[model samples]
Target: MRPTRRRATVQHTPAQQMLGAAEAMLRHALASGIVVPEAVVETVELACTHRRAGGEGELEPPTPALLRRLARAHAELVRLVAPATPRTILLLSHGRRSRLAMLGPVRLVRQMLVAVLVLLAAFVALSTTDYVNGTGGDILNSTGLSLLVNELFFLAAGGLGAAFSALFTAYRYIAEGTYDPKFESSYWLRFILGLMAGLLLPALVPLGADAEAEGISRPLLALLGGFSASVLYRILERLVGAVESLVRADSRELRAARRAADLAQASDRARLERLELVGHLRRLEQQARAGGTPDQLAEDLGRMVGTLLPVAPQDADDASDEHPQPLISPPAR
Candidate 1:
């Protein structure tokens, strides 16, 4: 046997070590639906990959290039994962004696599981066929019978709708956030109105008459499916909010019902800052086109130091397959 060669183990520098740790942490956040932007991943990757290119055993401190990437990654992390007050959800359930209940993390998991099951049911209804097979043949062609098959599908649709309705009624208690009997009765009445609307909306959809198949019609079958789906989604909004809050470990949407204005103000400030920078660049381009001297251009630019802060500020925001270089400074003269 040929001698087995042991490949030399690559020793990562401190920069690489830190980058690897950061990438792992960011991945965990992403898996939990925290929305870690792609640029953050790219910055971490570039920091490690570029530093590794410098060769093994080079224990030098992180270069400015690595530092800048780290700074970008830090900014992204701060934006996404900054600590906030955890919001509480009111979860009112019923026993013989009714009282207030709170939605702890475990109850949140149960809600998410139901949401997943609802998605599964919706997928099955969309994918499976009981009435018609390919080439317009009867579903049970051997005996030349498709009547029972048609009924079976209609029954399935009814079952799906009933299942959705039960889930809807059960979730209404949690959705309302209170166990007041009078309020519950009022809400139930209003819910019946919307449920009727969902059922009727499907029939109102204009599926052209001539196009449907001869037996039981595709449009009618489709209408049943849409009705069930609509009912499913009615309960789904609450389910989604619960799942998102559970994933984020914060019920910002549930507690406040509106996001913190600081986020919006920051966004508006960023937008205005972006517009100002673009205007500054346009003026500089006009100066360059007019053949202004470097001295005049420099003076004009010097006057707008605060305005000409940066362009495409969130370039690394989506660090994906395309590895964008982190902006370290203004463009070279």
Candidate 2:
């Protein structure tokens, strides 16, 4: 009878098989622009070779090199693929509530300015009627002094109106978040326009002949206009508080949403890392069964788990084979 050749049968453990599959998938993904860790690639390669060599009965421990490679690969994989979870999102949202709070201040300033301006305008207009001339003539009594005083008061009122309008508009712009240093130049421009309006209002609105005879004085009219402007500005400030409160509430909601998104990304990353570690452990077991001794396997596993894992060189030099020269050269001669 002829002697029969015994064929070696290799059976990979469940963990080994699982790791092998995971590694293969990872490699394919990396080639397609997916970024997998080098450690993962090394572990997979070792597992595959061990399986092919027909030494799968015992669960062999991984070599130091294999373990180190796995650790690195898993770490890299987790970093590249994981994202945050929903709970984390909520936490992040809560952290940014302050940004939303700022909206309240913005709205409050707007309402106050409007109220103040209206009140001041009414006061200035009313004061224009109370002037007397130095000549003992009632400016309101059809005298030239009375007419001039009325005209001056009207002009002053107009200037005050323009000033209130400009200041109100500027306040609104600031509340709306449009405040800029460049806009300061507009302040002077608006002031000049207000002064011009004050000069022109008297010319535009005719005073009654009786008022001119009463002799209204210019100084009195100017004082009344100034007082009206001051009152208007104060009223505006008070009215804007409610608007600022509403803005604050809205801003808080926005901050909450942003925080939630960030948390989600972080959670995802952590989960991926755990999965990657499990995969690496499976690969280490597979590598040990192939041919490595227990010590060698443990060493490999340790190296794989270590912080720095060595990568396989793409262009490693091949070892040369040498044949010993015949001790006696006589045979060749």
Candidate 3:
């Protein structure tokens, strides 16, 4: 008779499986040259030792404490290696939060559709009502309510315009694969700006001037203003520039006139000084013709020199040292 044969089955416990997975991750990190710390590697190796200590068929399950340590080691290893991993895989492994980010583009498109539908429904409701024609007696009974309703109509049109722009923008971003949740806030801010543009454009500008003649209505103009808020902003900027230019032109003319007046004053002052100098010269000539003495002539000439070139206090001593020299050689008299 042939010898009997023995069959052995192998089973891996949870702790062993976890330890194996950690070791596998560590090996991959080392192979990829990810620079994991030695402490982390030692911790992972120590956890792996427990599985190897029990030889084949021994089935020595790890205690809860050992399992926890093993789990921590595995977590650390994954953390070290995650940065080198691709984003798509990281998103998948990280659970719902990351997956939700992946859905941002879709969510934005849905929101755009919903907003458009809401605006359409509001427009339909307004069109079917007598408020559109201003013929509903009870609805228009209160003047305040009438004004409020008109404002609401303009807001709705503005909202519709904003919705249209947001839909197109979201679609463009989605196609480019660069969509992000941060862009949602920008879309909302644009909507608010559009609403303000719609309400303020007609009031600040004369949009209703040719409404009756050109067959255009106030709400239609508001819609256009909201749709092209940038255009309205450009127009307002140009108006401000024109007003500033006008003010500056007036200021420039005033400055020119002031400068001319200053020049005239300076000219008059110079003429008066020249007249005074001429009078002094005439007196000196009269003295000379009257046969004035050398001493008197020297005194008059020194006085004239002192008046024309006044010396500073510090230079007065220097001027005195040179006083012995005759100023004009006694005029050769």
Candidate 4:
């Protein structure tokens, strides 16, 4: 029979276990560089409450201030333990995902405008061709449509097409996270005005011998008017794209500025932490001087200095003089 082997069990004090778990979670999150510190704090709070209640479910929730401080400390620890590279942060924040989200709508809008313009050009070219004689036989008459029906059909098609195009473009822009209220309003206004202009074009054209001789029937004129409206719609779409690009650029800059501000704040917090560490070391030094065995004094002094001094020359140079020297060069072991 195989000899029974016993599993070794390591024991920890309550405080040690709590701190160890918190530190482990924090380190893991920092190493991954994905989980935010707030998440860790939330987990810690939950764990602490569960533990305090002795597994009886009577634990009280942590106060808001306590949770906030825990989160702040967690973030500080991450920064101190595993600072992220600037390039990494930039890539994560403004890389392919962000760019796609910002510019996708703009591209779609541009394509829609191109399509509209092409359609308008074709319509305009066809309208310019002289197909009817002064006797009167145009595309509309060729189809046997009454004057009112032809005009109404052209107007309805033009208005509907323009409205649908505008709506589609707007929907795309909004979906891509490029929606701006002012721009949206302006675009709609331009679309409506363009539609009106398209409707007025037929009425605006002078009824002269040339118009009649050119073989331009009422339906053809109305179609030309609709084409004109589509042209205006295309122009407006392009303009919206331009404006949206500017807005997106501005938003990116603002986000970058905010990130920079966050980094500066983190640096400030780190500096304050260093100051606190120095103060703590000073107190330890004073206690050691007051009374302790030589060995104890030496150990305590070692720890205090270790906490104050930087592990690397670069760190030492970077460290403020007001702070205590760092403990032994971060132990190479």
Candidate 5:
């Protein structure tokens, strides 16, 4: 069996319903953290053309002042309802979705630098044995399988160098006294790029050993490699931070754009409602001047009120009217 529920109804005048609509919008704004002027509220509350107003102050016609206040309130309301903005902490985490989505100018340059550092680290590792054997360690002399033996040493050194470079960077980062990893922008991509850059290390080794590098000893070359890798690591950190800032800026702009649209829409809607209410008030004035009875004035205003200012959606379940709901009705007319 289907059960049909009966809806309740509340009696209200045309002016009262219009005021209710304005009040509902004001409450919505307040809930959304907007601060509307008290004057607007006063105008809506004091206007008593539709009320008995036994001893209450008589409300004057809609003045330029009242309209302006309503206009400002409506503008503020929509602007307040936009989505909340992102925090700085959200932007910096290398895990930010925006960063993962694409690389920017700073990020690209930073990644390239990281690649170079990784290659240098690999080079330093692969050439360590050769440097030692050449400098009188003659460690390869007795191995008979000198090339094979040295190749293993090269592999060991490269692996260790790569490991140490990454470790050193992490250690330095931790030592910098920042306990919040939320602000960290480091990623696996930088390390992987560094690995790709490692191939260039062999060619770099000769440059270090050449006549132009006269004062550069093996230890000095190792120091240069370690120092350069660390420097590149710092540069990448800074560059990624800039990327986070860029992302945050973009996020802020997006929110602002949404708010601007809302503001314009709300303002336009509020303006339309005001214009309709004004027309209704003007008609009521004409009826009163024509010496219409209170009941007739109310009936006439009632027929038009449904169209001028519809009730709030939240009020739907609480009340219903016998007259057709204008906004809900088809525009067949």
Candidate 6:
């Protein structure tokens, strides 16, 4: 048998951990070309330097104020350069439970959203039970549950699909470490889209002889449409495109206008780039011409040549002769 190895258990004091975190943050800031604040410098100094007191050499422990300043600086730099940096670093640097405690509210809100979605799904399931079993009574009577239950049934199914989609999205982002509280509103929008898709799909794509033969139901189609709203959206987009295609003259005019705008934008961008190149050439020309190293001379010469060369135009219209290509094609009869 191979020799059994024991894992080393190395524990760090709070001060040492804070110092390490500070050092790590400062190193990250330096690597990212961010400015290190004075507080971080002080914290580093206090943590590293030993002072002689009572003839004993001991590190000048970092003060609370210094640590607080360091924490703020670290947080600011982390937010600017790498927002996805784990909260454990902040917790370590701050030496406080409250650093992670702030996320409690966000967690609670997500849980509440998930709970509401679950309830909605359960309610929808119960509401459709009789209908699915082919023992349905009047689905559109005057009672509160039946006033518009026929439409509400499909809409709720769609909402349930949206909820599942949202949950899946949240799971993906959380697993990938890219979840942010700021994008919660987008999930709400998705839910609304799901509801719309759920309601509209039944009307747009009817289940006739083929669907009955295949055992497809209207509500089931609505749920599927809600679950894949993007596909439903593409279907609607294609319908709109086909309608637009029927009016060839109007479509051609729209295309021409869009092309003209794009060409104008390209022309403006090219003019700005040329001006910038001219400015760079002028600055390089103004720099000292004497006693420069060979590497510096070569770099300057290369830049000058690069700035002076004629750049190929990005647009075909810009590169072609003065008689430009027609922006619009003749509308087909």
Q: Write the per-residue lDDT of candidate 6 for residues 224-314, one digit (tens) a residue.
A: 8777788688889999999878866586788999999999999999999899878876666566455567687679779778876888776
lDDT of 2 at 330: 75
Worst 10 residues of 4 by lDDT: 85-94
Clashes of each: 6, 66, 0, 8, 2, 0
Comparing 3 and 5 on lDDT, the stronger one = 3
lDDT of 3 by residue, 187-302 (tens): 87887888887766655555334555776665776687777788679878999999988877677788999999999999998899889888888888999999999899889888
Name the better of 3 and 4 by lDDT: 3
lDDT of 2 at 307: 31
Candidate lDDT values, in order: 0.52, 0.52, 0.68, 0.54, 0.49, 0.63
User: Each candidate: RMSD to true structure?
Assistant: 35.9, 47.7, 17.5, 39.1, 40.6, 28.8
lDDT of 4 by residue, 1-333 (tens): 999999866465534333443555454455557455565566666656645766543334455665565555545544643443222232223333544544323433444466466656654554454542233333334444334343444454455455455766667644443444446565556455545645555555445667656786544554444435655446557878999887776777889999999999999989998998888778777777788678876787778778767577776665666586777778677
Which candidate wins on lDDT? 3
Which ranges in model 2 have alpha carbons more than 4 Å from their true place?
1-144, 205-333
Task: Give the range of the ten consecutive residues with the poorest summed lDDT in model 3.
Answer: 86-95
Model 2 over residues 1-333: C-alpha lDDT tens digits? 999999978676545645553554454356548766565676767766755565646666566665566555544554443342222222223323645434223322233345346546754664545553332222334466566555555454555555566666756654333444355556546555555545433333345557546764443334333334444344445657667766666767788988998899889987887787777777777876676688877886786677345565545433222444566777655
Predictions ranked by TM-score, top down? 6, 3, 4, 2, 5, 1
Q: Write the per-residue lDDT of candidate 5 for residues 19-114, one digit (tens) a residue.
A: 444555555456657667776556555443333453444433345565555455444433443332112112223223454334311233245345
Clashing pairs in 5: 119-197, 119-198
Could you tell me the TM-score of candidate 5? 0.21
Ten consecutive residues with minimal summed lDDT in candidate 1?
84-93
Clashing pairs in 1: 38-318, 38-319, 39-316, 39-317, 39-318, 39-319
**Error at 222, model 5, angstroms:** 6.0
Stretches > 4 Å off in candidate 1: 1-145, 179-333
- Supply the global lDDT for candidate 2: 0.52
